[model samples]
Target: MDAVVKALSARVDAHDAGEKIVHRPTREEAEAAVRTLIAYAGDDPDREGLVETPKRVAKAYRELFGGYEEDAGTVLAKVFEDVEGYGDMVLVRDIPFHSHCEHHMVPFHGSAHIAYFPSKGVVGLSKLARVVDVFARRLQTQETMTQQIADAVEDALQPRGIAVLIEAEHMCMSMRGVRKSGSSTVTTVFTGIFREEPAEQARFFTQVRLGK
Candidate 1:
């Protein structure tokens, strides 16, 4: 099941990899594609209000999918060695983010809680939030994004342990399929000590849900 899921995600990530590698489409081409979609959806692309819609959507796509242009490692590259030898678990919770559903191209909005045991030094608190945003700004499945965020942090910091929990409401389920509104999905990834120690996992869960 895990292998199948990974395969599916890889396909989604490489939707147009061939074209992208050869020659990415220009802004005009993107706008034209949007216009084609508008027409296919039974809308008049030439209509005054909709005439400019394609352009707007194309522009929005750049901002919405900008994560593809960023590297999480770069964001986490700088570390602070001045922790005064303070070695402990650091937790950041209630990080709000929104991402497009890779399957339906809709949206899923959520919060991510991250915890890590610093092996050597510590990173800026804001860097963690930035990490969440970096992944959130891309087309994703909650499960895949959860793993990606955990992997990115683990690779960059080489922490003793890392835990990532994400809770989200996928619009694909509510807006289209089952139509079950107000339903949220949660996904988590634990590495190293967090994976080995049940107590640490329990502590993470407790802290994440402490007030909420």
Candidate 2:
């Protein structure tokens, strides 16, 4: 296993993308590494209690972070031409998500609120969730993730305004660092009219905060 790690590490080093290497080990390699971790932790991975744990974890990852395999534009590409020129803020709230924090590779569970006012056309509500998924799938901080959601919506639709709010609990903080069980992180991003017009932003915020 050490030899395998050495070979893989060499490959990542050779193809290093930047300061924080974005190496994606193959599924087989990832599962093998998980098996090694189970063994290293003094667990008999082949035992009935743990027999399929590695495979399960790997498969779970494929689902949890599947955004990498999808394109955000494809999801939002369909736009409505005839809103009859009815322009108003389109708000989508409580879009559920679970992402891994790049810092600790631990879960950060949350719901997102996305809002945008179309200038010429509008996208469906579900596309808002797809926009969130793209940034969430990769290593992220809440601040950057929030901005990404807003920016993508604006870039896609040339909207009059864009707002994104994220509220999450970081397992890295709750389960390990300081271990504060109830601590929650909230972040927001606003642009265009949402930034210039206070009332518009407030309207979006008020709606997302309801039933929170």
Candidate 3:
């Protein structure tokens, strides 16, 4: 069992290492790109009012895309086996998050609900929220973000089942094409028992919708 765990851990480490950017642009370059976009928008980049806008935008990009520097596996590394033999679904709901739409590079704000059935080990509850944030801080589609959260939890805990649901309002939809204001998008992903058992899936959804 130790060998198996070590092997899995090594694989996860390698995967995370591979995901890192090798030749990323410098801060100055990023600021330059932002200036270019400002100019393209018919603004004077050198004007007094806009002189610092590119630097500010570049700084904001660092925060918005910070997930690229995080590893979900690392956040989920610590697990507790002292659950007192509690073996049932553990759900965390209403975890608010902000992400950029990969398609339009606009903002999307949402809440995520995650649930998992542990076998012998359980992770810290806050780690689940951290997992959500790690994925949420990246450029993503609602559908892809949901699945990524589910997959990250499953990979870390080896849970018997996992389910993830995300509901979000996309600025691209409301401010651009279609202009469907107040409309939200939802995406769900189920794995293991959540995928195999209809009753379990229903229970997960019920728990997720309990107060919302």
Candidate 4:
């Protein structure tokens, strides 16, 4: 619906800054849309068992897609420059996340591995996980999400090198199409030194796969 698209577009930063402001639809509108979906799915929306489903779905969507309301730059704004010149590879691995596949609107859950060689300073270890969560709580493809995470870090930290790897099992494939439940998709993005040096890329992979 136009209302839904407008509401979603209102939350995106890229659509701002010179674009006309589009107001987000009311909760009632969202619920109505959900009811429409139920009817389209051949379910009676007014049935007692399904009467409250629309409301529940609307609430769940707010939490699931809360990433649209967040800014990754704001999360990574505070840089800790007091690392005592300890410039080395900071790797955070096995960060669990669940995202919806943009194409099918089905879930793809996975772990992310992030590494950056700090130049100016370092960020809190937990911030890395938060960054991952920010991007994950949205409709996305694994490849685009992987690069978005890396780009966010690269922009915020200006790291000497950055490496990001994400592996996810898409429900679109497992629950529908091919029905390959255990098959996973891996995507990686490298910048700066990681892009230039194969040894650094190998080290990153080694660190991520260690003990696994």
**Per-residue CA lDDT of candidate 1, range 1-212, in tens?**
44532332321243343634323466778899999999999999999999999889978987897777667899999988889888789999999999999888999998999999998678899999998988898888898899889988988889999999999999998999899999999999999999999999999999999949
Evaluated with lDDT, which candidate comes out highest?
4
Q: What is the lDDT of residue 149 in candidate 3?
A: 88
Clashing pairs in 2: none
Per-residue lDDT tens digits for candidate 4, residues 1-55, read 6566555656554323565555667678989999999999999999999999988
C-alpha local distance difference test of each model: 0.86, 0.78, 0.85, 0.88
Could you estimate the TM-score for every candidate? Answer: 0.89, 0.84, 0.89, 0.90
Residue pairs of candidate 4 with colliding backbone atoms: none
Question: By TM-score, is 1 or 3 better?
Answer: 1
Clashes of each: 0, 0, 0, 0
Query: Which segments of model 2 are wrong by more than 4 Å?
Result: 1-23
Give the TM-score ranking, best first.
4, 1, 3, 2
**Poorest 10 consecutive residues of model 3 by lDDT?**
6-15
lDDT of 2: 0.78
**Model 2: per-residue lDDT, tens digit, 17-41?**
4644445676678788888999999
Worst 10 residues of 4 by lDDT: 13-22
Residue-level error in angstroms, candidate 3, position 185: 1.0
TM-score of 1: 0.89
Report the Cα lDDT for candidate 4.
0.88
Model 3 lDDT tens row, 1-212: 44532332322222243654344566678789989999999999999999999889977876887786688999999989998999899999999999998898999998999999998699989999999888888778788788788888888889999999899999998999999989999899989899999999999989888858
lDDT accuracy of residue 115 in candidate 2: 83
